[model samples]
Target: MSHSEQTIEREIVSKGLTAPRLTPTSIDEAIKDEHYWVAPGRRLTVCALTLRNGFIVTGESAATSSENFDEDLGRKIARDNAREKIWQLEGYLLRQRLHDA
Candidate 1:
């Protein structure tokens, strides 16, 4: 992995978020070629968390800039998005549980 990639990975882990694996799809490859200035493949980042009740939540983000794309930033954004969603769900579930009780 590149230095930037490693740094991003560490940052994700440090934040207690799982590092997303970069898996490029066919469309991502095509887009990369069409946009030569951009990286040659997709650096899609996704985050997922399993709640104590076996519920799963996820968030995803991708590199936006063709030039000077920062994997670290992308990962952070994705993880944050995921974390927000998780909290929202948690709040809703807790409210429902309390209402039922």
Candidate 2:
């Protein structure tokens, strides 16, 4: 990857790592839907935790809005984004597991 691509990738991972963990937080399904307001009007973060076959998985979203900001919409969008990230992570993890197997 090019320098810019690497930077972008790092940013993405950083966002996931730095996202605020909601109440009852854990790697497991102890928490279902957790929302965190990262910035007053700039961004909102959310996460979902689940367990599958004794494995824990998490999904996160960092939603961004500039004009016409709405908290409800922002939260919804953030959750959707997090779910997308979770799917990507799941695929990557599955691939790694297969390779290691």
Candidate 3:
């Protein structure tokens, strides 16, 4: 097919790797609904896990104050933040699992 089509196919296959062993209910749940918080006037929440392998996997739908992010800047920001949080959580889980072992 076209170069873009091939690129998309490769991307899809590459993402199939690093699949988690256990699919926890919350693993696919939205970060915001999972954890709620208030920041005085503004509130923030996580809606997905950003994988180190460069995959944006969502356990639940994302929430945003903006009506539309056509430029996708909001998506990029959310993905970055979620990825950081997911990485941190993964580290914590790994340590805990090892400790339990």
RMSD of each: 13.4, 12.7, 10.2
**Model 3 lDDT tens row, 54-80:** 455433223355343222444445554
Q: Which window of 10 residues has the lowest lDDT sum in candidate 2?
A: 22-31
Q: How far in Å is the alpha carbon of 53 misplaced in model 2?
A: 12
Off by over 4 Å in 2: 1-33, 41-67
Alpha-carbon TM-score of each model against the true structure: 0.50, 0.41, 0.34
What is the lDDT of every predicted structure here? 0.51, 0.48, 0.44
Error of 2 at 13 (Å): 32
lDDT of 2 by residue, 36-76 (tens): 46465565444444434433333344444456555676666
Best by TM-score: 1
The superposed Cα distance between candidate 2 and the true structure at residue 35, in angstroms, equals: 1.9
TM-score of 2: 0.41
lDDT of 1 by residue, 1-101 (tens): 33554686678668887433331221122221110111355566665645555555566777664454566775666655655555455556556777797
Clashes (N, CA, C under 3 Å) per candidate: 0, 1, 2
lDDT of 1: 0.51
